[model samples]
Target: MTSPENAPASRGPVVWYAALAVVMLLGVVAVVAARSSSNTVSNKVATAQTSKVKTGSSSKALPQLMDGKADAAIGQIIPAVSGKTLDGDAITIGPDGTSKVVVFVAHWCPHCQAEVPKIVGHLKDSPMPVGVKLLTVSTNVVKERGNYPPKAWLDRVGWTAPVMADSTDNAAATAYGLTSFPYFVVADAEGKVVTRVTGEISMDTFDQLVKAAETGKAPS
Candidate 1:
């Protein structure tokens, strides 16, 4: 009943509409697939980049040293703490049946900045006695502060000690009851604390503390 020219015109409109609908559907599906793929990739990246920190339980926190009187932490076992190094290598500092002289330092502290080089130089001149392990903890890190990246600062000072990178929550510091920068904890072979000292100390004093750890005796 329809004329030929009019029939063709009607068919043309219907065909064009169907083609446009197909194209729109395909575009919507492509966008959805792309968004899902992007989310999956982002989740994988976040998981792979996460840093881990592990700390052991402590019965009592170390008392803050005031005028050389805080020896409460002495005779207590040093907490078993484990964390990663600057290069992402795993390390643990605990009672490993070896004497340990652990020093905790913050990159921004002036005293720590002055102390590291002296320790490094001393170690270079006189290595620690056999069976004694010297460990360093990089803590209280602030990217906006001076000596921002502790690894670079330590490397520049020719530090050869194994470093334990602390977490953002200062977990290692808290586990050890850190009260100040340039903190020292001397633990004997059984992991019992022999003594603790803070602030910059003379290498002679440092040697004495190391001796205390070696002998399992608290310094006088």
Candidate 2:
């Protein structure tokens, strides 16, 4: 039998113990809920960013070429080479004494993946000059996208054109006065420059230029 005063004091401890247990359980639940909410928010943010890059807005793509005035000086010199092919030998730009090199490359460019194939097809079977040679060069801009292909990967891609390499700084790209990739230029036999084409072109353009070279006509 306990005294009346002592009884209340003993009951107080039991009450306090139950209250503490309830508080601890509530704390644990709150922590778990907060972590779950944070993870959900993070996942949503990641998905949105990826979507943004894929669905580029109207402002980000290459501007469509029209009858606007284009600076012809953009493509003045041939894009020089800084790397060899997959084999240890030096990658040759042209065999013909007067070579007409068509460089298919990009500036940290994903579009190059598509444009490169078309350029390759044209150079393989297009009507080039009898004494002219053609080539494709990849600017080392792929490192920016974190998807730079191995040198060998660029070589095997259905290209009959001899491929060359550029420095990460794109030194060869600068010589042609091009600030972008998939650039084109025609060099005369004596290494005199003909014309510099700055945008993506079709096989017809290559043929047109070859005809232009033969006729001494500047490419339109």
Candidate 3:
């Protein structure tokens, strides 16, 4: 039997409770939004870090070669050479217990530019001897030279031979007696230098050199 004006006084506690619930709900919503924002930021940072790692791995700096004439000689035991490939894999020469026909080339030499493809084509048509391995050394790399980056040039020509990048000091080339561009060194299974040829050579001459290396005799 309360009067109409007194009804509001009875509902005061209920109105206060409803307002408190709304405030609590808004607080929960705000917290959820903040957490979502934090997660989005974290994901973006992780993605950027992953991209940086991939970029760092793909681009590697080329080395500089030392200035000097190679001292490699026939009948001499050549030292072992180790280096990385364009793909960043390690390669070691003369340690696999196999005869090798090593070709040394420079990116800027016109003769080498012509001779490399020739050698690659000839070898593809007529493979090396059973126990003989054909190896290529990319040496004397220079930024201002033709075929600036040797790896890209070799890829364009489809050079399938196992290639080793010489050190900044051109250690591999120096060890194998690099007297000139497009140098060929034939070595026996025990890593002994059997013979060497400088400048461009015919496929027939290359075959003779391989034969001489396998038989431990000079080509007549």
Candidate 4:
């Protein structure tokens, strides 16, 4: 038969190889697109987390201080009612039963940066005085400066003290008449204001304040 004499020959090897190459190219393009989308999503998540740390507020209580409330002392007694840490952890609500609470910090303030490492080291390693507690408050709102103390900064500085975001309204800053950075405010076990020091207080000075509060002896 005529058909038996010659059927159209199949595609040549080169043609088939070319088709296979095209298919492989398409697969590579699809994979690249998928990876790009995944990278975008990951980038968005990281940016949001870091941004929140820069501008988030813990709560709204310090605003009352602006209204000129002297009973503010009553409010500071409860730490949870005050502020929160960068990692969304509880800051010092008040002094523990055995220790007074001392806050040493500033938000944009430069000196606070220097004081952090030593203070955290002492607070972590040394035993608390009988009437000592440890707490910290931001003197400035993180604001647009992105200057707020983010968890990243705290971790980088190795500050372990329970820190509060006083940035919402400068409540802590106003409470102690903070005129500068690196301020220290010590509250006795009873949550009474005992000592207020401006500028950097040496580790020795910190000890004196705590020991004096506990033993009622002034710095030697």
Candidate number that wins on TM-score, 1 or 4: 1
lDDT of 4 at 45: 18
Per-candidate TM equals 0.73, 0.55, 0.65, 0.56
Which ranges of candidate 3 are over 4 A from the true structure?
A: 1-72
Give the alpha carbon lDDT tens digit for every residue of 114-153 in model 3. 9988877887888887988888888887757666577777
Clashes of each: 0, 2, 3, 6
Candidate number with greatest lDDT: 1
Q: Give the TM-score of candidate 1.
A: 0.73
How does candidate 2 score on lDDT?
Answer: 0.53
* lDDT (Cα, tens digit) per residue for candidate 1, span 1-220: 8788667545778889999999999999999999999887542211111135687665344555556565778788888888887657888989889999999999889999999999888988788999999998898888777765787777788888888888888888888888898999999999999998889999999999889989999778
Name the 10 consecutive residues with the lowest summed lDDT in model 3.
46-55
Ranking by lDDT: 1, 3, 4, 2
- Quantify all predictions' global Cα lDDT against the true fold: 0.83, 0.53, 0.72, 0.56
Q: Say which prediction, candidate 2 or candidate 4, comes out ahead on lDDT.
A: 4
Model 1 misplaced regions, further than 4 Å: 1-51, 57-68
Instruction: Give the range where candidate 4 is weakest over 10 consecutive residues by summed lDDT.
Output: 44-53
Candidate 2's error at 116, in angstroms?
Answer: 2.1
Error of 4 at 166 (Å): 1.2
Q: Can you list the residue pairs that collide in candidate 3? A: 64-168, 65-168, 66-169
RMSD (Cα, Å) of model 3? 19.9
